[model samples]
Target: MIFPTQYSMLSTEALKSYLEEAYGLNNLGCKLLIHNVSDTYLLAGVDDKYIFKLYRDSHRKLDEIKAEVELLNILKENGAKISYPVTDLKGGQIQSFNAAEGIRNGVLFSFAEGKPTHDYYDSRLQTIGREMAHIHNITADIELQNPRKVYDVRTTLIQPLEYIKSEFTELPEEYAWLQSTTEKVVEKIRHFDLSKFSYGYCHYDFLPHNFHFDEHDNITFFDFDFAGKGLLANDMMTFYVHFFFQVMLKKQSQEEADKNFQTFISAYRQVRAVSEEELAAIPYLGFAFWVFFLEFYQLHFEDWSNTFYNLRFKKERMGWIRNWVEWYCRF
Candidate 1:
């Protein structure tokens, strides 16, 4: 009898063979691209490339995986520029593999042309804003048959704080600071007129890495791993975080980053109505983003980021959360 395993890495060669047979494609090659919360592989054929993502049972269940496929299909059908799932010979979008950790699901996605860029020229900023607004228009008021998370004060702020408390047993002061700041954030959000906000399925991670711009400057958005129900402004908030980091690292002046963000907002307004109230709440919401990811790192440390998740990393994350509060939050 074999010992039970917690997690396992699938063989690239076996995956290549399986995919070729399942999709009826010849001359296929597979290589692991990323191994974070999920495993991503780059698949290349004679003339085309594709991405295959294998999901962990602990991260996304079958139902949530189906929801992602459904969402991307809808977006593609509506002409939203995105990297959607590709069907196999049986017209199936999902493939299952029995790994050491039990049943794992995988999906092959259409390759998004071009590469990701950090330098967002004015024209590119406008493109991002317009594209994001177009996605929001479709995601808003739509319901998925499968379950997905909802980002709220409980999930992003309160619950994450609770989940990470055990991990901070050795750092009491930092944990206390986190609790104190969360209270301030919750109170500040309490005063907002949330009814003015547009609710939708937001791509929680809208950083430059999740999108690509081709030679002709056309953009295609991918990686819906963290898509969930939330304020549509949450997408804008994630994009804004890119600029915040630029200013923090001294790569761009605060004034310049702010101006660039404004350019994006203005373009977004051209397509959809965004209120001053929702915009004002971005800084507070940004706090939730940090806290949520901090908890995420702690939760998946053993499985994904074991090499980097240490005491020093925790303290560094605490500093980031602190900086976010001092630089952006009020009260």
Candidate 2:
């Protein structure tokens, strides 16, 4: 399968060759499945199920991969209802392959049995809350051997502003708005004390897409690519901000949005209750989180030439930012 952009370093032939060579399979029935334009993921059908994830860029280091493997294994050992990395017969979790293209890393994982929860399920939400809380509880005491770097909100906001001013001058209106809004956001973030919040190993990137729901509505979380040491509130804000943008913003009525938001918050609070101070900080951090994702897409757009960021989705995200900023200012 050809990758969508030039930045993607992995080629189909290279990946296939590496897999065949690594597993010593003469002929393996492998099909490319769920290639997220940003990352190449393949689901090869072996005697059992296995997933091969090919890193598209060099931004991720081997150490990060090892941390994820170790963290997942730890969670699995603690009975967290999450999938762990599959080991080869030799009992190796990671396999390094040197192909002509580059040294790409790949890992195998047992096929997690479940579907993504598209709509809200109370039990599933409760389970997710409890599981996430349990994960935090387990990792809170254990020091991260290789903690990933913290994502700076100010840096995230500034990069896009610079890019728009230096690179894309065509969309004058959008660029102007982005610049002004980024300035205001930067000002707001400067006064906020993020260090005061509780810090620990957070999922960092939990969304409906990353979760799997079994027939019994049990949610199993996956894809710990962005897992690292960060503020617990930051992780919660990230998840809430995404859900607000993707689900709440689309609702036609205020009641509908409020109801959905309450359900999510209620479920979340049940497992890990947020303090009043944390609740107050949500509006600010929520805006900061939106800025992070906004810049995240901008970084992708600049790095990957063929990326389509879904303009409508971005507009909705900006709406969330504007509303949160307004709400915070009033309070």
Strongest candidate by lDDT:
1
| lDDT (Cα, tens digit) per residue for candidate 2, span 1-331 | 5334434345666666666666554454555665552354554554555567655444567777878788888888888777678766566777775544456566766667778855665565567667776776666656656546565564446654575354335456656766676676667656666666566777767777778888878777777777777667666666665555544456434455456555665766766665656655566666555655555565556554325666665565556666766645433
> lDDT scores for all predictions?
0.92, 0.63
Tell me how candidate 1 scores on lDDT: 0.92
TM-score of 2: 0.78
Cα RMSD to native, each candidate?
0.9, 4.3
Clashing residue pairs in candidate 1 (N, C-alpha, C atoms within 3 angstroms): none
lDDT of 1 by residue, 11-115 (tens): 999999999999987887899999889999999978989999999999999999999999999999998999999999999999999898799999999999999
